[model samples]
Structure formats: structure tokens, C-alpha cells
Target: MDSSRGTRIRRRVTLFLLLLVASSLVGTSRAREAQPLPTAAAGGGSRRAPERHGLSLDFYAKTCPAVDQIVASVTAARYKDFPAAGPAVLRLFHHDCFVEGCDASILIAPTAAGAAASAAPTVERDMEENKNLPQEAFDTVELAKAAVESKCPGVVSCADVLALAARDYVQQAGGPYYPVKKGRKDSKVSLAGKVRGSLPRSNSTVDELLRVFAGKGLGTADLVALSGAHTVGFAHCVHVLGRIYDFRGTRRPDPLMDARLVKALRMSCPSSGGSARVVVPFDVSTPFQFDHAYYANLQARLGLLGSDQALSQDPRTRAMAQELAGNKTRFFQAFVASMDRMGSIRIKKGRKGEIRKVCSQHLLAV
Candidate 1:
């Protein structure tokens, strides 16, 4: 072929690709406009406003004006040394909020009094569901709490500190900078038994995930947007072993998974006797970035978890996934809205909760 001919062909191919991307973006914009925003409901009725819970963007303005700055400073310092702290802290906030509402119950250590009150003396963090939560997340919270305590003493609650730290890490990791409403108080109760049905599993179907989120006053959009957190972080082999191996007794890997991904995962997680501690990034393409790549991975059948891939496979959620994959701005906005809602779940205030000087121990126990 002549050199000029090859150059023309290359330029034409580039133009075609750009057009394709632009078309997809236009389609996503139309789909987003067609849908109405989802609102939370309880027993088929509207949810009470988050403001009714006494949370506010400046809840700490008078009591501890420097709370946000202190938390942000600690999160940035920790993240500089350990970038994994960003995802770890994000996961920590989700886990803490899901169980017993965003009250920091997950941070509580087992106490003799707590043990005597229950059949077994286990705290939320020791439960099987929460066992894999990274130490970096816990350390981030502890450090932030210590910093806040130095400046404000007991003025800031551990729950509020955890919320602020989660937002800070998300911003530092290249995600949206959303305001976190404060005023949550640490829960005195942190039972291991409460962990069983509150969280979603790695292999959950879309319908199952919807039901779980619905039970918590969240909608389908919230579920999908929150799942974008998988754009970062990782999962232990134990979570993906079934999908990559037998796949619900089919004696084959999950068909939803990409062929290349299946081959790659098998290398790290063999069918027989693989190390339980082995982990894999949730998003193979840019695993450390907090972005829309997660939805794109789903569209490509490259989602690492069965639950994540289901968003693209299920008819109810596929369009939303495509829209998010095409529009990063939309995904970021939805994520911020959902995080605000999730942060408001069953918050504790007044005499129902207390401000703890130490995050890991209840004041009574301390």
C-alpha cells in the first residue's frame, strides 16, 4: 500500500472511533433525561427528610469548627503513605453504615459488658462478613479521631469523624468533593449477630441487591451508583472462588465473566487449595482510580464479582450501567446523592448515642 493511503486509512479509523464515542454519549444523555430521580420509601411511603435527623453540612460549625480540616489532614497524610487507605476507608464507611446505621458501631471492640449481654461476646468487626476489612481503614479512623480529640476533645463524635474521613478519602482519590452532613453519634451496641442479613454478598443477583438496598431506604440508582466504589479496592479469593471455579455447581466458571478474566483469575485462585488471602482488583483497568471505569468493565463483562456484572446483565439496570459508563459527570453526581442518603440511615442523636473519646471502645467500657 502507498504511504499516503495508509495515512488516510489511519485518520479515517480515528474519526470513526471518535464518532462512536460521541454517539454513545448522546444516547446516555437521552436515557438520563427520560428517567425520573428515585426517592426512598418506607412501606410504600416517602422517607423522612435527612434534615429531620438533625444532620447538617455545618453541624460542627460552632462546636468543632476545625473538624473537617482535621479529618482531611489526617486522611491526606495517611493516604500519601498508603494509597490503599482510600478504598479501605470507603469500604469501612459502607460497612459501618449498612449495619446499625452510620453510627460507627463497626469500630467498637468487644467488651465484657457487651459480651455478658449477648449469647456470644463478638463485636461487629470480628464478624465473618467484616473480617476482611483492612487495618488501614481502622487506623485512618483512629488517627483522625485522635487529631480531632487533640483540638476539640469530646466535641466530635467518632461517627462524624468516620463520615468526614470517608468523604475526604473519596475526594483525595479523584472522586467528587461532596459535603458530609455531621452530628452522628457512636452507637453503644455492636453485636456480631446483627451482621448476617444486613450486607450484600459477592454473588448476589440484581434483584437480591435491590431488595437489600430497598430495606435500607435506598433505591436501585443508589445501589448501582454505590457499586461504582468497586472502581477501586479489591476482593479476596475466597469471595470469587465459587464464581471462577464451579459457578453454582455448573462445574465451570461463570459465563458472565470475560474469558480472559476467567483465565487470569484461575491463575491466582486455582480450583483446589488456593490461598484464601489472595486478592484481585475489582476493576482491572485502573483499579486504583475512583471513576466510571467500573461501569465500563461491567459492559465488557470484565466485572470481577458476580453481583457487579449483574448490573449490566439484568434488564432493569443495564441502561443505567451504560449511561454511567458513558457519562462520568452523571455517575459522580449520583454517587454524591447516594452517599448523602446512605450517610443518613437511622442516625443516632440526643440521648440515644454518645460522643466517645476513643473510637474503638465504648465510653461505658472505657
Candidate 2:
């Protein structure tokens, strides 16, 4: 009970906490590395639902009869206020799907109970690739979720809200109107460490991108169509700096880029450093129009990201990009089908996860 005894106890406790934090980080990294990439079907590679859970459009028919209309109205309302809302919502779904399936873990913030039970203290939104996700996207999803909760109470999952919101966003943006399956439960396990590894890098080749999608049963054609989502959004300069400035340590612009396109990019992002915050449309021709212009831009060698250009540069995906650029109807059909596959990536069902009361926080510990 002396002063020295108290001081010693406090120091020991501080050191113990530091060691525990370090150990948890190491454990998370190792576990993420050990985890296998998501895949669909054993060998069939069909666009059917996974064998474990029954995912259907009518999953919420009885519980929330007007679920789709509710989500569509809210999304359209948000889109009217924020023009970029379409791509922002779509990006959330894309990020959620590529990781452990469209389980809505990106919306979950880390919680004491979730960390204690899962031994992971990080959430998916904190990942570097996800840092630039527009604030408009998060706001739109939260608004839609609150609207759904008001009517349906706890019947709908945040995962389904996001998926349905994405579908509505696409239709509002002039893309195809597609059916999205429901009944997905929210996942509590979100690791900041897994996102970078799980996602395809901008500098990745066509082969690497193809492999990333194939793990989820998507083919080369699917990759081309999904990439078409770039049609509506804009990319910040940081994601395009390497390709515009020094690609491959050459101290020159990317050789694959059209000379005039390079000149135009330099105007937006100067050769002099420090414009990483500047923004440019994914397709300069029709940045606001959600259509086949993205593929058309690639044909003109004006792709803003390295991965975008890779689609037209690499022999494997090049032909598909060219074909999609030419045929608007074909592009829409392929995109709808690819979106269906992406939304079904990997999901948790009734007993596997919980319906979140708050989209940004895990369900409170009972």
C-alpha cells in the first residue's frame, strides 16, 4: 500500500496493455494471411445462390412487402441532392462484395464486444483503399437504413439495404434495372488488415484482376462489365499520379497513354508535385452519365487508372473492352449479370449473423 508499490503496479499494467495491443495486431495480420480468398461453387461456377443460404428476391416479401420500393425512393431522393451519390453507393457494394462477400461488414465500426469475440479490433472502412470513399455514399446509406427501420423495424439487414440502394442508384444513373436478392445478415467481423490483400490494386495487370474476380466465379467478361461502374464516378489524383507522372520509374508518362490524353491530364494534375487532391472524372466524355462511355474512353487511351488501361492493353481483356465500347446494349446486359454475381459473393444467413440496429456500429451486446 506504499507509494512505491502503487507506482510499480501502474507501470506493470501499462506495459501489459501495450504488449496486448501489439499481440492483437500481429495475430490479426497472421489470421488474414491464412484466410482463403472467397470463391463460388466447387466446379460449377454458375450464377446460382450458395448452397448454405437461400438468397431470393422474395426473401423479405412477407416481412417487408415493399422493401424494394422503400429503398428505391430513398436512394432517388438522395441522388437528387447529391449527383455523385450513384457511384458512391455502388462503390460501397463493390468493396463489400470483393471482401468476404456482400455481408455489410464495411458499415460496422469496431466495438469492445466484437473485438473480444473475434479478436479483431479493426473495421473495413479504415482500410487505405476505402479512405477516399465519398462521404456522400455513407450518408446516403445511413439515411436509407433509417427510413427502412422506421417502417420495417428490425426486419431488414443493412447488407440488403446497401445492395438494394446500389441497384436503385444504377437505375437512377440510367444503367440497367436488375433484380437483387435479399435476406443477407450483417457480419460483425471487419478487419482493416484484410482489405488491401483482398482487393485488386490499381497497378495490377489484366491477369491479376481476372484472377481476383475468378476467385468469385466471375470470368474475364464479367470483369469488363463490372469495371464499367467507373462510368459515373471520378478518381482523385492520388490514384492516378503514378500513371500520369512516373510509370515504371521511367520519369515519363505511361507509354500506353495517348499523347493528347497525357497533355490533358497534366493540365489537371501538374508535373509539379502536390495536386494529389485534385479530382477528375473516370470518363472525361461523360463523367456524369452512367453509360458505356467508360469503355469508350479506354478505346481512346484516356483511362484514368492503370487498371483501367490494363483492360485495353492486356490481350486477354482488351477484346472484351473493345466490344463493350462498341455495343451499348451488350454492355448493359453484361453489367447487370456481373452485378448479380457480385452481390451474391459470400453471405451470412439467418443464424450466422445479426440484423444491425445501427449500420455504423455492431448490434449491442445482449
Candidate 3:
């Protein structure tokens, strides 16, 4: 062969080998990126090992006794007639966190403007206004916290007390176990109106819900998983009004929803009332329990929100909801898995993020 031709052939071979090596590296890097987090159990899907050890659980348990005591004292001080107010106070945080992730910011921070500073604003509002608030749940945690404080001072936070109370509440109600991750510090800044703006509405279309979830770095699957929280709470008539009224062409309730139920919901929520006359807890049948009843209700067209029923229409989320609906175990496993994923979203970890003393102001805190 001519020397020039031979040289050209050798160069081509070298280029091809280099291309192969580069391809291999790219493949390896992608696999690493896509790998699931490590969980406590082998092959337990993808679970990232928690950074702090049993610290979260220990802190949660340690702080509970004090929180419980405080709750008891506060309820007694405030609502002498309503003796169960303490444990009810604790549910505010649990319901909020379970619906979202354990971002304690929801309890104290306002996600919007002009809203009053209150824990679990949406849920608590209906409860307080209608005198329907489950005071017992709040009383339980407050009493526990008070004891903890008497024993350990302010070492425990209302935030940690909330996590522990939520965990126990679910178990007592025969729901899946929700693990607590500790080391979450408290934020002093609170935003009231912000809650309404930040939360997904019952009338929200699938597109809107997708945007809200994505804004938090979640996807369709996460939205569906998070909606599983509907399994536990209930919606007041006011929440589903837009759906019945068809406001802005965006609040279309599912055709699958029971017409009778829809009519009743509409009638109960008169146009003139300010959260009065009628109430629909997010999960009416089992309002305080974390169970699959929410999904099961959706199957029967009894889903409280248009967004909840809409889950059945989306291809990606439909199967998940169906899987959870078919079996309680499946729902629990998926809920935990999804929560783990949701909790990891957009987290500013390591040197990348700071633990702000307040969540409402900004990531950096003013």
C-alpha cells in the first residue's frame, strides 16, 4: 500500500477507538446519575442514605414529650370547653407536610400576601371557622411538647413535635409508616396569604398542577404521588366550588365524579357564604388517617378535587394511582418512595445551600 494511504487508514482507526472510549464514559456517567437512592432495605427501590443517623427520629421523639405538654397547657388555656384542642394543633403541621414534603415552612411562613399567619392555613381555616377543627389532634401534640420542654428545655421545636405526632397519628389510624428525618431547624418568618397561592387548588387543571409541582422540581409522577395525600384530608365546599361553577373554563370537575355528590357539594357551598353552612374535609370518610381511601374514592368518582380526579386521565400517573387503589401496601410503598423523591427535590445541599433561619423571606434569608 502507498505510505499516504496506510497513514490515513491508521488515523481513521485511532479516531474510531477514541470515539468508542468517549461513548463508554458518557454511558457510565448517565447510569450513575440515574441510579436510585440507597434505602435501608436491599433492592428497596432507589433510596439515598439519610445524612444524619437516627438523629431525626431521636430528635423527633425527644421533643415530643415537651410539645405534648405545651399543647395541653395551651389548649387548656385557650379552649377550656374544647379539651381536645392540643392534638388537633399538631395535625396542622402533619397534614401540611404529608400533603407537601416535610418542609416545616408551611406551618409558619406565608406563601402569599394578605393572608393571616397560621399553621396549615387552608385546612385549619375550615376547621376553625365552622368549629370543625379536630381539637383533639392538636391537644395531643401540645401536651406532649409541654412535657418535652419541661424535661429538655427549648431543645425540641414545635416543628420536630409535628413530625413525630404525624408519624404516630398515621400508624394509630392503620396507615403506612411515614419515617421522620431530623435536623430540620425552625423558621421564624411566617407568611399567611402565601399558603393559598402556593397550594394546589381543587379546581386546578392537570396542566396547572403539573406547573406547580414542577416549580418545586417535581414531575407528573411526583404530582400524582403527592396527590395521594388527598387520601387523608377533605375539601370544604368552598374548595370545590370553582369546579361546580366551571370558573374560567379551568375548573371542570371530572365527568366521572358522581353527579349527586357534585350537586350536593354545590348546594352546600352557597355563593354568599365565607366558609360557612357547608364543609367538606379533604378526606371526609377518614380525614385524619393516611390510607388508600382517597384513591379508592377517586375510582368511585368521589374524589374531592378536580385535580384529584384528573389523575385518572394522565397516562403517567393513572397507573400509579390505580396501583395504589388496588392495594394498600402498594400505595404505602409508593407514597414513601415518592416522598423520598419529593423531599430530595431542589434541595440546596452540601456547600451548595444554607440552612436559613426563616423560609418565607428568601433562600438566603434577609
Best by lDDT: 1
Tens-place lDDT digits, model 3, residues 95-120 = 44433334344433323544343443
Q: Which ranges of candidate 2 are over 4 A from the true structure? A: 1-52, 110-120, 271-276
Candidate 1 lDDT tens digits, 201-316: 99999878877787678877788889999988778888888888898899899998866677767766777787776667787766667888888888777788999999898877
lDDT per prediction? 0.81, 0.75, 0.49
lDDT of 2 by residue, 1-366 (tens): 124532543353344334434434111100111122122232234444423366898998899999898988888877766667788899889998888888888877545565465765667887888888877787778888888999999889999999999999888888888888888998867878768767777788876786677766677667788899998877776777778789989988898876666666666667667555556667665666778878777876768789998888777677677777777777788888778878877788767788987788777642
User: Which residues of candidate 3, in runs, are more than 4 Å off?
Assistant: 1-91, 94-103, 106-141, 192-197, 246-254, 271-277, 283-289, 340-366
Model 3 RMSD in Å is 22.0
Error (Å) of candidate 1 at residue 46 is 8.8
Candidate 2, which ten residues in sequence have the lowest lDDT sum?
A: 25-34
- Candidate 3: worst 10 consecutive residues by lDDT? 25-34
User: Which residue pairs in model 1 clash with each other?
Assistant: none
